[model samples]
Target: MVKQFVRQKARNITPTQFIVFTYLTAVMVAALLLLLPASVKEGKSISFLDALFTATSAVSVTGLTVVNTSETFSGFGALMIMGMIQFGGIGIMALGTFLWLIFGQNISLSYRRLIMVDQNRSSLSGLVYLIRSLLLLALLFEGVGAVLIGSYLLAAGYYDSVPMAFYHGLFHAISSYTNAGFDLFGDSLQSFSNDYVLQGLTMVLLVLGAIGFPVLIELREKLVKKTPNFKFSLFTKVTVTTFVTLIILGTVGIWIVESSVYYREMPWHQQLAYSLFNSISTRSGGLATMDVSEFTSPTQFMLSVLMFIGASPSSVGGGIRTTTFAVIVLTLVNYALGRSEVRVFRRTLKQEDITKSFVVFSAAVMIVILSIMLLDALERQHFSLIKIVFEVCSAFGTSGLSTGITSELSAPGKVLIILLMFMGRVGILTLLFMFRSKVTKDRYHYPKEELIIG
Candidate 1:
């Protein structure tokens, strides 16, 4: 039976392998569904490369579409994309666990291990509860978002009928809260650029999604249970602090860099709205209110930096992660100060954590640089270097914000971006681990040697 074979295969592979396999499977399935005749508009067939690219983007929850989602895909196709977003956003294992619980099936030890790795938990304890809580919270947040957005759209006559408005609202609600960034609006919310209610709601949903599920869980517990004298975990503190700091800095940075060029004719409120939305969107939200190309080169470069840093770990978004960036900075600061240890919040970090942070950061930079180089060679004549770099970073960070070069990319360029999106979703470290050789104990120690380094 298929179930027996799957169980056997699952037993033979590590959790990391299983996770990668799950995403690949999801991508393939989504691609096939997207290629279906019903999935596309009448009489139009999707190209294999574009279909695969869109599927990968949706399954990875990265919104870098090679085709215009609203015009190219039918309602059924759009729903299929939404399904992939949900699967990728919350993860396939989490959804599987929820179904297993609903069916009254026992979650085996191996299944628990999969869940642990999927959610980035260190232990197996309370994983079922965690899944239930995660799903419930996701539904609640997304449901409220849908209602609010739908009501506003209908009241404002954005759509002709209630059903159409509701569908768009629901689609955007899921997309925003999952940080999937796919949009039904042709220009990706440009019409609503000055609409404070929609933008504010979207920003909040994006933050909640990108802040990591564990942090949300902790916040829920603290706020709902009213825990007395409660303190947040170090992870929560570091992630929140870094996330907020980046938003503030990015907003100000973009405003200062582009005020003279991009926003010179706009009012102060419109300027603020654009800056804030773009800042948050660059951090893996990807739903832009305006064309990214309108900004100056310096502003585009800064947005690229924001996208490269991305969102928090164990969340829907990608990039090197907030904590990793924070650790790298802290490590440098301490080293410059000649300190014995890198400490944050009066707590000393483990040597392994520091090493891992550096590895992740360095590896990410290498991947982005290499990707940019490849893209430049492929599309240099067609696009500017800054646009190429921005696209590469968007793919790597899974940020999905583009300067209008996505559709113009050649076949090879699309494939490269597809690979970057996959790597981003699976994570640099996870991908490295997937190819890492098995460790073996040595019977004897090698002679120690010292090498000079900067």
Candidate 2:
């Protein structure tokens, strides 16, 4: 009777719900781990709420923190945080499958479905193989990043010892590759502002982490496998085109906006570097080479807009996703030209994808706006609207850029941010799927009617 009851309860849980619950459970467990006596500093203690927020941020790879990670946590706690970042940055199921493969365990259909839901993939076929390939690639990239970063730190006199330098190198390497953005230096990449080597490497890692994995996979196949007549998927094409375009626009927009402010006296190279870094970071990296608050009001808001768009689908970063933005943009352009169908790259997009893109975009905007309004209503007496707006967008994007207001948010505000981070990481579509009503056929349909025209 107990077994039957448990089975029935299990049957009631949808894949999306299970994925959501799994992330929540992981966050809670990580929070608990951070609270361990071994994890905390010798003289420090962290509150439950802060620990949870930090865990959620790390797990979501958003990098927003209410407390300073460097000063508050011991090596043990840092390790726990890094573990969360790795698993969270890599979809939980992908890492799960990796461990399973290492153990020589058989993959099951049920597990594949979970992977599909987790990675936001539609195909069950090749999902496991994709997982195996991505996991290896991630490791390879991180290892190289760690070695280069650590060696630079040692040679450039950032650290006194090899072990300590490599330790930081390893942490930053993982954080950058995962787009986790956590820093041990206590000020993010701000200290390395003049160090273009670190900045370049970090940017490369961030891009690798945030660009869609399928794009990376295809590029790898073209390069390594020497595949003949290999073609980039439409998803890849749209994603890369949109990503590059956004970064270019963001870099120029930022440089122009802050021309009379942050860049007024800066060298051209520094101007270009700072603008490009902020643009990329705002998209998903969250590790800033400049203080976000130091920027002009227009630049800050521009970054908020960038954060709203966030990263590509199936990447470490989160948002409505680059492809969604691309589809929506294409649809709007096609509509403006009186074209009925949306076509790009010599191929017509599926009507289903176009519709889903709008759904995701509309839902994301609604979530961001409502969250901002609610948060302002909650904390307006203390914080200004723009700060709240930036925080809200940052949380929802899981981008982690902030104007130094994160720690000051009230408990409810923190909880709201937590919810946004989880939603962003878990995904808008996945959340929609989780609460959707079961599919059913209607016996009859009401007459179609149009009430208004835009």
Model 2: lowest-lDDT 10 consecutive positions = 290-299
C-alpha lDDT of all candidate models, in order: 0.92, 0.92
TM of each candidate vs. truth: 0.96, 0.98
Candidate 1 regions with alpha-carbon error over 4 angstroms: 1-10, 437-443
**Worst window of 10 by summed lDDT in candidate 1:** 430-439
In candidate 2, which residue ranges exceed 4 Å CA deviation? 440-444
**Per-residue alpha-carbon lDDT of candidate 2 for residues 78-158, written as tens digits (9 for 90 to 100):** 989889999899988998899899999999999899999999997889998889888988999999999999999999999
Per-prediction CA RMSD (Å): 2.1, 1.1
Clashing pairs for predicted structure model 1, backbone only: none
Error of 2 at 421 (Å): 0.8
Candidate 1, lDDT over the whole model = 0.92
